[model samples]
Target: MICLVGAGPRGLAVLERLCANHAGENELVIHVVDPFPPGSGRIWREQQSPQLLMNTVSSQVSQFTDESIDCSGPIRPGPSLHGWLQSHDSDADQGRRGPDDYPSRRLYGRYLRWVFDRVVADAPDTVRVVVHRATAVALEDADNGQCVTLDDGNRLAGMDAVVLSLGHSDTELTGKERQLAGFAERHGLRYFPPANPADLDFDKIDAGEAVGVRGLGLAFFDVLALVMEGRGGRFVPSDKGLRYRPSGREPTLYAGAHHGIPDYARGRNQKGVAGKHRPRFLTADAAHRIRENPEATFRRDVWPLLDAEVRTVYYQALVAQRGGSSAASNFLKDYLSEPDDPGTLRRHGLTASDEWSWERLGQPWRPHEFSDHATFNQWLLGHLREDIGHAEVGNVDDPVKAALDVIRDLHKEIRLAIDRSGVIGSSYRDEVIHWFTPLSTLFSAGPPPLRVEQMAALIECGLLQVVGPEPQVRTDPTGACFLIGSATIPGKQIRTTSLIEARIPKPDLKHSANPLLCFLVETGQCRPYHIPDPDGAYESGGLDVTPRPYRLIDAAGVPHSRRFAYGPPTESVFWFLNETIRPGIGSMILEDADAISRAALTC
Candidate 1:
C-alpha cells in the first residue's frame, strides 16, 4: 500500500499522476490522509465565505490534464474547472460563468471536490483509493517500511511509498507576536494572531474602536472585506466610482506595510492566452548554463534575461497600442537596439517608471504625508481609481500592466533556474526569495481589480485608513493598548485596542507547530533543508529533499527512496512550488509529480 499525506491539490495532483502511471495495477492501494477535505484542503475549503474570490480566472483552473499539455505520462484531456461547471446541465449559475470571470473560492472548492471524486471514479478497479479523514501525526521507519501514526493513535505500516504533499501550515506566534499576546492577556487588549482571514471573528472589536492591521497582501484583502462588507456595508456604482453605504458596524482600520506598498491591482485577464507566453532568452540554453556552472548567481545570470523578457513584452505592447506614433517608434528603436539589456531599456525610457510613474506596479512612492486621515483617504481613493482604470483597459493596451504580466509569466523560467542550480541556501537565493519573489507577486498576482475599487469605496467611507507608509506595532508599557507608528510619519502614532496580523508565515520545519512535522524532525526522518552560502557556509530552514525524485533527506545524510515531497516545504529545492498545479510547459509541480509517480511505480 502507498500513502499520500495531506490530500490537498498538490496531493491530488501526485495521486492522479500515480493513477495514470499505475493504471489497472491490481496490487496498488493508495491511502490518502488529511483532516480537511481531500482536494480543496484547508485553505480552499468550501466553508470559506463567498466574499473571498480566487485571484485566477475560471478558465485557468483545472484538475484534469489536457491535450495541449505535454505530460511525460498519459495525457487525460478533460474539461477545466470552468468547462466542467459549464458542462453540467444542473448548475445553471456555474454554466453562465465565462472564462474571464473570477469565481468565488467556495464555488471553486466545490469544483475541486468534484474533480477529486471524478478521479476516484475513473481509477481502475484494481486501484483501491482509500481516503482517511484523519491527520497523519507521525511517521516512523519500520522493519518492513514506514509506519504512519494517525492523530487517533492508529498506525498503518508497510507503505510502499509516501508522498508528503502537506499544504500551508498554521503560523505560530513568534518573538514580537508572543510578547504581544502576553501583553494583550495582561492588558485585556484584543490580539488576533496570524490566521486564515476567513476564520477571524469580527465581533471581537466594537464598531467605533480603532484596530491596527499588519501586512497588505491577499489576506489583508479578506480582512478588509470582513471588516467592511461583512458589517452590513454595501458598495454601489457611482459617478466617481464605487460608493460605500455603511451600516456603521466596522471598527476604524489602520493598515500599512514596511514599504507602505499595497499589492498591484490585478489586470484584466486575456481569456485565451493563459500559459501561452514563451520566453525567448530564458530558454533551455540559459537553464543549462546555470546547471553547468557552480559559480552562477541568479541575480547576475538569470535576472537579466527575465528583466529583458518583461522589457520586450512591454515595448511590444507599447508599439501595438501606439502604432505609428513617435513615442512607439522611439520605444521600438531603443528596445531593438539592445534587445537583452535593462540599462538600454532604462536609458531609452522603456522602464515601467519611465512609461508611467503612478501606474508602476509594486514600486511604492515614499514619504506619504497627509495633513489628516481624510486627506490620506482621498489620495488612496484616487490611487485605487487610477489602478482600476489601468486594469479595465487590459494589459495589451496598458504598457505597465503588460510589463507586470510578463514578469508574472516568467515564474516558470525563474523556477527552472532555481531547479537547475539548487540555489536554496545561497545568499542570492535568500535575496531572490525574500525580495524579488514578493515584488513579482505584488506586480503580477494581486487581487482582482474590482476589489481595489471596492476597497477605495471603503476608504472613502472612513471604514479603512492608510495610517502609515510602514507602520510598526508595539504593546503599551502599561498594557492598555497597542501603539502603531510609522517612520514616514514620525511623531504621529496611533493607539488601538486591537491588532491583527494579516499575512501567512513562511514554512519553516524547525519552528513548525504541526505535530507530524515536529515528530518527523525529532525522529531524524527528515532534516531542515540547507544549502551553501556564497562563502560556502551552509544554512538551514527549508525542508530537506534529495536532488531528484524529491525523496526526503534524513538526518544521517541519506535519501529515502520510498518517500517524496512537493509544494511549500520544498520551496528551497523547488523555489516556486507554492502555486496551484497546472498542465503547462516547465510546470515544476506537474514535472515533479510525474517524477515522483514514476519512482513510486518502480518501487
Candidate 2:
C-alpha cells in the first residue's frame, strides 16, 4: 500500500507514474489524501473567479504523457490540456480557445479534474485507488510500515510508503503582520494578511476609501480587477490604449513594491518560433559540471554561463532584428555593457533619457533620478508603454524582449542541475534560491500584457496611485490609521485606514504553520533541511531529502525510504518548485514522480 498525501497535480503525476509502471497482477493499493478534490488542487480550484487568468498559454500546459518524457516503464500518452478542451466540444466562451490564448484558470481547473478522472478510470485492474477527503495532520511509524493521522481523529495504517506532495503553503501571518492585524482590530480599521487575491473579501472596503496595498506583481492585478471590474467597471481598448470605464464604486488604492518595478507584460507570439529557446551556452552539460562539483559557487561557476547565454541571444536577436547591421548592434551592445558610462552612451548617440531608461531597466529603483511623485509617475508611464511596445512586437522581433524570454527558458536547466540532492554547494544554493530566482521571476514570468495595460489605466484614472518603491507601513501614534512611507519620497507620507500585503508569502519550513509540518517537526519523524556552511556550521531551511530516491531525512539523520517528499517543501534540494507541469517541456515534477514510484515498487 502507498499513501500519496495532497492529491494536487503533483499527486496525480505520482499516481500516473505508479499506474504506468504496474506490469503483472502484483496487487497495489494507493490512497490519496486531501480535503479538496484531487488534480485541480486548491490553487486552481474550479470555484475561483473567471477573472483570474493563468499566465501560461493553452498550448504550453499538458496533463498527458508525451514522447519527450522518459518513464521507468511503458509510456501512457493522452491529449494535452488544450487538446482535451477541444475534445470536450463545449461552446462556452472560455472553451474552443486557440493555442496562444490565455485560458481562464477555472477552465484549466476543469481540464485537470478531467485528467484525474480518466487516469483513475483507466488504471490497471491490479491497482486500486482510494481517495480520502480529509486533512492529514500527523504521520508516524507503525508496526507494518507507517501511519497517517487525520484531523478528524481517524488514522490510516499499513502503508508501504508515503509520498508528500503538499502544494503551495498558505502561510500564517508573521509577527509584524500579526501586530498590524491587532492594530486594525483595535482601531476599527480593515486589515488583510497575505492570501490568494481571489479569496480576499473586497466588499469590506467601501468606495472612495483609500487603501494601502503592498507589492505590484500578479496578485496586485487580481486585486485591481476584483475592486474595479467587480464594481461594474469595464476595460475597453481605444486608439490611445486600454480605457477603463468606472462604475463609481472603486476604492482609492495606493500601491507599490520594494523595487516599484511592475512586471513586464507577456510577449506576443513570435512567428516561426515553434518552441522555447534552445540554449546555446547554458546547456545541460554545462550545468552538469556545476552539479558534479562539490564546491562550485553559483556566482562564480553558474552565473557566467547564464550571462553568456543572455548576451549571446541579445546580440543575435539585435542583429537579426536590425537586418544584419552588426555595426549598429555592436554599438548598442557596448552601450548595454556599460550602461552608466557616458562615453559609451555618446559613442552610441544615445540621449539622456535613453541612458536613464537603460539604468532604470537594470535596477528598477534608481532613487536619485525622480524628484517627486509627478516625475516618478511620468517615468513609470513611459517605461510601461515602451515595454508594452516591445511585447507587442513579439520576443523574437525585439532582442531585449527575446533575452528576457531566454532567461525564463534557463529554468529547466537550472532545475535539472539542482534537483539532485547534495549536488549544489550550500552558499551557492542559498544565493541562487533566495536572491536570484525570485528577482528573475518578477521580470520574466509576469502576467499577460492586457492586465498590465489595465493597471496603467487604473493609475491614470485616479483610482490608483503609485506610492513610490519600498513603501513600509506602521500604526500611527493615535492608533487611528497606518502611516505609509517610502525611501524614494523621504519625509513625505500617506495615511490609510486599511492595508493589504499583495504578494504570496515564501515557503519556509522553519516558520510553517501547517498542522502536519508542526507535528512532524515537533516529533523526531522529520526535521528542517540543512546544508553545511564553510565554517562547519549548518544553515537549515526546507525539508531534508536523500539524494537518489528522494526519501525524507529525519532528525536523527536516518533516511526514511518508505516516506518520500515532493513539491515545494523540497525546494532546498530542487531549487525551483512553483512551475506548472507540462509534458515534453522539462517537466521536473514527472521526473520526481517516476523516481518516487520506482522506490515505492521496490518496497
Q: Highest lDDT among the candidates is held by which one?
A: 2
- Cα error of candidate 1 at position 404, Å: 0.6
Model 2's TM-score against the true structure? 0.91
lDDT tens string, model 2, 277-394?
7876668898877768776666677666777666556655665564466665776577557644677645645445533233456556575577676567777777788888888888
lDDT (0-100) at residue 55 of candidate 1? 83
Write model 1 residue lDDT over 213-294, tens digit each, in one string: 9977788998988877777888889888889888878788888776565687877876363555578778767876765766
Model 1 stretches with alpha carbons more than 4 Å out: 68-70, 89-96, 271-275, 324-334, 339-364, 367-374, 420-424, 538-540, 583-586
Clashing pairs in 1: 529-542
